[model samples]
Target: MTDGDARLTDICSGAAGGKMATIAEYYAGKNVLITGATGFMGKVLVEKLLRSCPEVKALYLLVRPKAGQSMQQRVSDMMTCKLFDRVREDNPDFHQKIIPISSELVQPGLAISPEDVEKLSGCINIVFHCAATIRFDEPLKHALQLNVIATQQLLSLAKQMHHLEAFIHISTAYANCNRKYIDEVIYPPPVEPKKLIDSLEWMDDGIVRDITPRLIGDRPNTYTYTKALAEFVVQQEQDKLNIGIIRPSIVGASWQEPFPGWIDNFNGPSGVFIAAGKGILRTMRANNDAVADLIPVDVVINLTLAAGWYTAVHRPKSALVYNCTTGGINPFHWGEIEHHVMSSFKRNPLEQAFRRPNANITSNYLINQYWILVSHKFPALIYDLFLRLSGQKPQMMRIFNRLHKAISLLEYFSSQDWEWNSENLSMLMSQLTPEDRKVGRPTKHAARLGQIFNILQLTYEPDC
Candidate 1:
């Protein structure tokens, strides 16, 4: 560990040398506020907290009505998901502990009702702000509304909370991807967030879209750019609030917790795994040796809970950022992932493959484009023609178009390497009690990955 991280451990432990409470003990009887409870990581955070900290007083979920479902209905449906089966078995009335607060993150004041606001201000002990627009192509103005503005509003609300102990913000490890090396500190913003927000408010949509490129500068897209700004916004509140920021890299499948091989966070490698298993994706540009940095969702949640406890209990003077990545330690490469995935598919292949399971990756741009034309477009064109002749709507080309867009967005991260210093995570884990870290040694990533891949055979989606 670096001197900075070693010092952090000391601050977390202190010189009293007293017996510290375990993670569950600290969270007992605490009222927790969680935004984005319906999201991939947010749901896992909720499940883990309920399961690990069984005595937690209540969970207040900030949710919105979507697809005609009310906030209460959404929370009710979420509680019944297969993801919560283990929690259900452990505590059949787990639903009683959840209280949904109507909130639309993009709206002013988060659109939270006055009653809900008053309720939250009086009893909330800890908060986890996990909501953000993760779309790579999301418009800059809309992205700012949800990621930056909503965060500011939430921070303001936290100031009113009489019992609030800690606030943990979720950010991506690629927030500072412009740099080759990233440390456990928020970098200077690309542009001042307040200034940019002020400018965008007066401009029209087209003007904002055109100026976004100049504003974001070297960052790949609005997602990373805005996430970087959100960190700064969170940092600004350090004096008034105990804050901890967790930056996770390419969140992958669940590790051992409720169960191994559960696949909920499918936005990462699972897309490639499923598409390739169904024999759709054949080739893409990726550096074979680049560290993939696929941190499991379960481990990320564990680290998140640990950080929440540390920030609330130790009360660090400065806001601590935890780069919750696996690149620096237990390094895994893209080539190893492709090998394991392909091997698993061959053994227990998906029932319906568009072609024989033979997919490869390339580092060369020209070679990848060549394969895209020959392997991707050519197959889609032929398949669409067959469908047209059979009186079926030709849809292969549309699917391929979406696949190409996804690949274009993914290749930037896949074709390069970024080093994230995760000493803060190590320091946080070092202070946890044995029960908090009681899972079996999980060094056999190869086997764990094989289990995940084999399970994917049963989960191949026909839709792109």
Candidate 2:
């Protein structure tokens, strides 16, 4: 074995003998504060914490009432989801440890009551800020409101916590997609966040839309632009707080922990995979050799929890950034993904496929458009006609239009490549006890067999 592997093996063996405090022991009796507890990655983090760190004092979740459901009801519904099954089986009364506070991120003071603020300030030990709008099509104003302004608000609140140890912010690796090589550091944002927010607060929507192209420049969408700003904004708090930033690239299904092939969202590549599996998406633009850089959700959470511990215990002078990715180490390509997904779906076809699970990806814009017209538009037109003759609503063409728009927005990322330095990720892994490092490997043999059996049975992610 290589030197790195040997070192990891020694760490694991030492952990087996209880040589040091494990991650769970470090979190014991600590109160944790989490934002975006209702989100995809957020739910997984909560589940892992509850199961792995069972002795933690309590969990404070920031929530907002929506669709007539009270904050309490929403938290209750979340605890009962299949995602929390392992936690539930481990401890039926895990709900008792969850304390939900009603607060709106966009509102002044985060819409958090003074009493709730006081309560959080006294007892919370660690904070994980995971809430942000991940939609590519969101307007500039709303995206900034949630991604940048809310992050600033959270940092303000973190400053008041008497016992707060570490603050962990979740960000996307594509935040600086304008660059070819991204290091583990925050780059300068396109425009100052406060200036942009101040200038746009009074402008009409149409005017802002007109100027967005020039404002964002090379970044394809507002999502990445605002996220880049959020990173810069969070760094301003580095002097006062022990902070760590995790930037994940195209989070995919679970690798082994909880279960393999466990996915719950259609954002990023999930939508592309599902659309192709259902035979709805026939063509997309992507460089075949471009690294897919899809990190597993469970792995991201593991690194996130580990980072929180390291930041709190060691108290780094500056914020440490972990570019949680798979490209540099265990690189996988878009073409390989397309081939695997298509092959899996063909052997185990979707319930009602529009056509066979055959997808073609190309780097040429003209070739991709040509296939879109012939393979996508033509098939959609014929299917809609059949539906119309059968006395049903003609929806196939409309669906294809929406799909086209989504794919068009996504092509910019896939058509190019970006290099990310992950020395921080390796450094964090070196700190994990052998037991923590070995959590998911044993289950892989069983999970892989089950994964092939289930194939591409994806869970529906609510369209945000």
Name the regions of candidate 1 deviating beyond 4 angstroms: 1-18, 434-464
Candidate 1: tens digits of C-alpha lDDT, residues 114-156: 9989999999999999999999999999999999999999999
Candidate 2 on 174-211: residue-level lDDT in tens?
Answer: 99999998999999889999999999999999999999
User: RMSD to the native, candidate 2?
Assistant: 4.0
lDDT of 2: 0.83
All candidates' lDDT scores?
Answer: 0.82, 0.83
Using lDDT, give the best candidate's number. 2
What is candidate 1's local distance difference test score?
0.82
lDDT of 2 at 117: 95
The runs of at least 3 residues in candidate 2 whose Cα sits more than 4 Å from the true structure, single-residue gaps closed, are 1-20, 438-464
